[model samples]
Target: MTNPFTRRPGGTPGAHLPLALCAAAMAVLALAAATGLAVDGRTVLGEPVWLKPFKFALSFALYAGTLSWMIGQARRWRRTLWWLGTVAAAGFVLPEISAITFQAGRGVRSHFNFETGLDSTVFAVMGGAAYLGWLMTFAMGVFLLSQKRTLERPMAWAVPLGIAVSLAGMSVGYLMTAPTPEQAQALDAGLKLATIGAHSVGAPDAGAGMPLTGWKTGAGDLRVGHFVGLHALQALPLVAVGLRLLARRVTVLRDLTVRTALVVVVAIGYGGLTWLLVWQAQRSQPLTSPDATTLTAAATLLGAVALAAAGVLLAASRRVPARTPVAATR
Candidate 1:
C-alpha cells in the first residue's frame, strides 16, 4: 500500500494535506485582507470595503482547520472519499473567497449586487458556490454518523449533533435570498431591480449596524443566527472536550452516561438558542433588544435545559462507584 500520508502515532489518521494547505492559504488571505482594512479606508454598505473579505477569510480558515482536525480523527476512511471531499470543499471555497476579495477590491458588495451584468454573474456564481459548500458540509456531517466508535461518548455525541445544527444554520441564509417586499413591490411596478436580496429586515441595508459584524442594531438581522449556527461546529466539540477533561476531577463528569447526557442537553439548548435568534430576527427584533415574550422564551429554554441536566447528574451520582475505604484506618 502507498504510504503517501505520514501517519500519526497511536492509530490516528494523518491530517488531510489538501485541506491543511487550503487552511494555510486562507490564513494568508485573511492577513492580506486585514492589511487592506487598515489602509483602504473605503466603505461599502456602511462598513469598510475589506471587512467582508477579512471576515470571510478568517471564517473559511477556521472551517478548513476544523475539517482537517476532524479528518485526523477519522478511522479506516477510504483515500478516494477523503480526496473527493477535500477537492470539492477546497475547490468551491477558494474560488468563493477569491470572488469575494475581488469584489471588495472593486468597492462593491459580492452578494446581492446586480447593478451590472458582471456583478450579477459574480453573485450567481457565488450563490452556486455557497450551495455546493453547504452540500459538502452536509455530506461530511452524514459521513461522521458511520465512523468507528474510537471517540468517547461525549465527543461521539458532539460531532454529529454539532454538524446537524451547523447545517440548519447554513440553511438560515436562504431566508436572505428570498425577495423582500421592496423587491416585490418594485417588480409589481415594473421597476428595474439592481439587487434581489438583503441581510436586514424591517430596516434598510447599510443602516445603523454594529461595528465589524454590520448586524443591524435596530432591526432584524438574519446574519446573527447564521453566525451562531456556523460556530456550533467548533463550539459543541469544544464543550465535549472540556467535559472530557473535567472528568479527571469532576465526579459527575467521570461517568460516561453523565458526560454524554450533558453534551446532548447542551446541544439541544444551543440549537434552541439558534432558533430563538432566528425567530427574533424574523420578528424584526434586534438581538440586544428582545421583547418580554422573547425573554420569557429564552428563560424557559434555559430552565428546561438546566432541569434536564440536573436530573442527569442526579441519576449519575447514584451509579458512580464510591471510594474504597482506606484499609479500615489500620
Candidate 2:
C-alpha cells in the first residue's frame, strides 16, 4: 500500500518519522478517548474502577508523542526546541500556581494508584503535560505554515491567536486551583504537579465516577473551560488538516471545503466557551441548604448546545468526503 506521508509534495525527507509518530499518538489517543467514553457512559451500569487510570497515562503519552513529532518535523529543530521549552515552562509554572491554591484549601494531598484510582496529583500533572504537548505542537504548526508559500498569512494569525486564547483558558484553570493566601505558602509542589498531570488526560468528568470536584470546589470546576479551550489547539487544526486533505479530490469545491472546516472549528471553539461559562455558573451555585436544581438546569442547557453543535458538524462532514482522484475511479 502507498504510504501517506511518503507521498508528501516533492517527496520530503524524514516523512516516515512524522507519520510513525502521528500514527502512534493517534492510536494511543484513540484508546484513551474510547476508554474514557466507555467508562463515562457505563457510569450508570456499574461502579467506576481504578483500572481506568491507564487512560490518563495513555493520554499524556499521546500528547507527548504529538509534540515530539511536531518538533521533529521542523526544518530547524533548534528553534523549535526553544518553543518546546516555553511550553514546558508553562507546564511547570501552572502547576506551581495550582499547588498554591490546592494547599490553601486545607485539602488533603490526594494520590492515585491501581487500587484507588485518580486524585488531585494525577489531575494536575496529566493536565499540565498535555497542555505542554499541545502548545509546542501548535507553535510548530504555526512556524511550519509560515514557511509554506500556499498556507502563509491566514494560518499564521489563526494558529497563534488560537493558541493564545487557549492558553488564556489554561491560565484560568490554574488560577481556579489556587485555594487561599493562608494556605498558599504551605503548598506541596510534588502533589500539585501530580494533580495537573491527571487533568492532562482529558476533559472534566471524562471518565466515570471521577467526581468533578476540585479542592477549591467551584473555582476548579471553572478550569474545565481552560481545558476545553486550550485543547482546541490540537483538535481544530487537525480537523482543518483533515478537511483540506479531503477537499483535494473535489477540485471545484476544495476551497469551500477548507473554509468550512475553519468555520466549524471557530464555531465549536466558541461553543466550548459558552459551555464553560455554564459550568462555572453551575459550580458556583449557592447551596443555601443543599439544593441542586440550578446546577442541573445549567448542565442541561450545556448538553443541549453541545448536541446541536454535534448535529451541525455531522451535517457539514457529510458534504465533504475524503479525497479520491477521479483518474482512479475507472
Candidate 3:
C-alpha cells in the first residue's frame, strides 16, 4: 500500500498530520486561555502567558500546511522532501514552542532572559535551532525554484518571491535583538536593562496595544512587518490561485503571459507594502499615524502598481489575434 501522504503528484495528506497536530496544540492553548488555567505570568506587553504559545501554534500550523502543500505539488522527491522538510520544521518549531510553554508554566520569561544558567542554555539552543530552521527553509526554496517545470506558472513565481519576502520580514527581528539607542544610553548611564531585545521603539513595550494583535498603538512596533512579511507565503499563493481562476473566466486574459504578469504585479505590490511597514517601524511611528511622507509613499506605491498592471494589460491586448471576418455566412 502506498503512503497516503506520499501521493506522487499532489500528495498533501501527509502534510495534514502536522498541521492537525499544530491546530490541536493551538486549541489546547486557547482552552487554557479561556479557562484561566495558567495566568501566572505576563508577556512584555502584559498579555496572558499562554498568548505566546497560542500565537506560535497558529503560525506553525500555517507554515507547515503551506510548505507541505507546496511540496506535495512537486513531482520529484515527494517522500524524501516531505520527511526532510517536516523534520527541519519540527526541529526548530518544537523546541521553540516547548521552551515558551515550559517557561510560561514556570511563570518566567522565555526570551532575552539570561538570569539563570538554564534559561541562558535554553535561549541559546532555541537560537541555534532557529538558524538551522532558516537554513532548511532556504534550501527548500531553492529546490522549489529548480522544479519550475512541475509547478503551475503562478506557483512557480509565488514560491520564490514569497520565500524572499518572508526572509526579509524575518530579518526585522534582528533589530529587536540589537541594542536600541535608548538602551545604549541607559547602559552608558550604568543602568542594566533586563532584556536587550524589545519590540517597541520610542516607547516602552508596556505601552498601549491593540486588542488581539498586541501591536503597539502609541509607537512603532517591528512585529507588524514581521507578521505581514511571513504571511506572504500563504497570501501570494492564494492571490496567484485567484488570478488563475479569474483568467479562466475572462477569455482575453486566459494566456499564461497575462496570468504571470498579473502575479508579478501582485508580488511587487506585496513586497512594497512589506517595505513600507518596515520603514514606518524604523521611523518609530504608529501604524495609524501617517505623516506627509507616509501619504506620499502610499500614493507612489499605488501609482506604480496601477501603471504596472495597465502595461501588462496593454501588452497582452497587442498579442491577441484579431478575429477574421467570415464571408457572408447566411
RMSD of every candidate to native, in Å, equals: 4.0, 11.0, 5.2
Q: What is the TM-score of each predicted model, taking all chains together?
A: 0.94, 0.45, 0.86
**Superposition TM-score, candidate 3 onto the true structure:** 0.86
TM-score between model 1 and native: 0.94
Query: Number of clashes in every candidate structure?
Result: 0, 25, 1
Cα misplacement distance, residue 326 of candidate 2 (Å): 12
- How should the candidates be ordered by TM-score, best one leading? 1, 3, 2
Ranking by lDDT: 1, 3, 2
Most accurate candidate by lDDT: 1
* Candidate with the greatest TM-score versus the true structure: 1
Q: Which ten residues in a row have the lowest lDDT in candidate 1?
A: 321-330
Better of 2 and 3 by TM-score: 3
Candidate 2 local distance difference test against the native: 0.43
Q: Lowest lDDT 10-mer window, candidate 2?
A: 107-116
Instruction: Residues 1-330, candidate 1: write the lDDT tens digits.
Output: 774454778766777777788889989998999999899999987889998998888888878877777766777554643764586566677878988998998999998888999999988878888888888877777676556366666777888888889888889988998888989899789888888888888887877888778889989999999999988888899998998777777766777767788999999999999999999999999887999999999999999999999999888788777642211110
CA deviation > 4 Å runs, candidate 2: 1-55, 76-145, 148-162, 180-220, 245-252, 256-330
